[model samples]
Target: MQQPPPPIFPIFRSRITCAVLTHTYVGDKEHSITALAAATGTDSGTMAREVSRLERAGILASRHVGRTKLVRANHAAPFYGPLRDLVTIILGPAQVLSEELADVEGIEEAAIFGSWAARIHGESGPTPVDIDLLIIGRPDRDDLYDAAARAKSRLGREVNAVVVTRSRWEANKDGFIRELHSRPVVAVPLPHGNAA
Candidate 1:
């Protein structure tokens, strides 16, 4: 007779499950229970119980590496893709914003700038909480403002941005655009009509 599947975990447990999977699959690292507990902000006892449950469900494997037991994803685990997607969602706006801007039109290049850019470039005191976009495009000022508004609505916070036409950008070559590109950039390609 076929054995019944394990019971589904609660939403909180689902988050912990996704975190464990990310460390195992995408991170591609073996983790001790203590490390997994710390990463997920859960207690060691809870982590142990969860790991044992996952192991029984055949989604994870454990091996004794010296005195420590190392945990990793089972290569044949069925939940790998869904688990990865959940992690992407939990990691928040920086990754999502980058993905969305990659589809915007008329933008030749886009980067996060200002204080955030400085921090990313390792020249800063602290990282800015909000995203700052520097866009190279020919978008009208009103259109750019509307886009920023929409992004703010979707992200639940102001998305500080500057959109400069290619001509204006080139003319002010020694200014913000040049300084932005001088730093380590997280570039996203915009659609052709949107190119600045």
Candidate 2:
């Protein structure tokens, strides 16, 4: 069977848009155009243009702070509720998790499972409070826990991770592992040269 198309927010395709949204909503900070540009890794000119567009569309609001223009999400905008929900529950988590796990070692594969996975797979219900992670290799437990803690603070949600050796994962003899692999999981892509 063919898979469904991925969720697309046209604005989110732009670096400036993601950066602006990240700061105002996810990062919970107001940012100047230059600052947002730096944060988003886009040229200041491009960031300024995008911020202008968003401001005019009522998605973001800007005000002068001394000589600098500070911009923030317009919570009163009609699109705010749904857009924030989409960014918060969907776009943000994937990006956040990827960054958090990118430097970790000895992970052959990692995936998000449980309710968050269910929702991403189109099963809808209340958004899950915590993120469930399955690591398919034996990574440093202390380091993994530290990364999970930082990720939790950054994502504003708890992260639960389970690490199993390659042998255990390949065998798939455990009922929990069987069930975990049986469900739809959002794969967490590893960084270049990273084993997982």
Candidate 3:
């Protein structure tokens, strides 16, 4: 079998760690560990342990409210700003896209292609200045633009979405399309609740 592709960012011990930190740092003000676990497809016990580890690192802070434990990035930590920025730059685009496009209709497949995806797949290059989202299948035009706008705002980077027909994508009739097919592409995830 072909060896798995190297991780985009190997700083985190696991993808789950990156996911946990990304959600906590970039998504909301606070989250319940149970909710975070469910969101990241991790078990609750493991999520709790991960949270505790982050808390010990001072990268996360938690408050226990009766039986509810709420977790959030520790803004008070000295390294919080850099740490947050790091995760945001690395994983924020995918997270933002999923959130914005979750309700968008008729998306058969979606992904990040071009430079951002290239960087994620371990290619050495300058930091990507924008995100290229390839959307296959017909989706509502206005809704797609609206979602891209919101994602751009959150990412602090431009998001350029190209609508491609399923037939065009599958046939790969041109140099550009074939080039995309040859490169590393990061699949844009559907929201957990909406995954088919």
Best by lDDT: 3
Return whichever of 2 and 3 wins on TM-score: 3
Model 2 per-residue lDDT tens digits across residues 79-109: 8877776676555665567777877887788
- Residues 153-175, candidate 3: write the lDDT tens digits: 87888999999888999999888
Instruction: Report how far residue 42 has shifted in candidate 2, in Å.
Output: 24
TM-score of each: 0.44, 0.59, 0.71
| Model 2 residue 22 distance off true place after TM-score fit, in angstroms | 9.2
**Local distance difference test values of all predictions, in order:** 0.61, 0.75, 0.83
TM-score for predicted model 1 compared with the true structure: 0.44
The regions of model 3 sitting more than 4 angstroms off are 1-17, 29-50, 62-72, 75-86, 192-196
Error of 1 at 166 (Å): 1.9
Assess the local accuracy of residue 165 in candidate 1 as a C-alpha lDDT between 0 and 100.
Answer: 72
TM-score of 2: 0.59
Off by over 4 Å in 1: 1-94, 102-104, 121-124, 154-156, 171-174, 191-196
Worst 10 residues of 1 by lDDT: 1-10
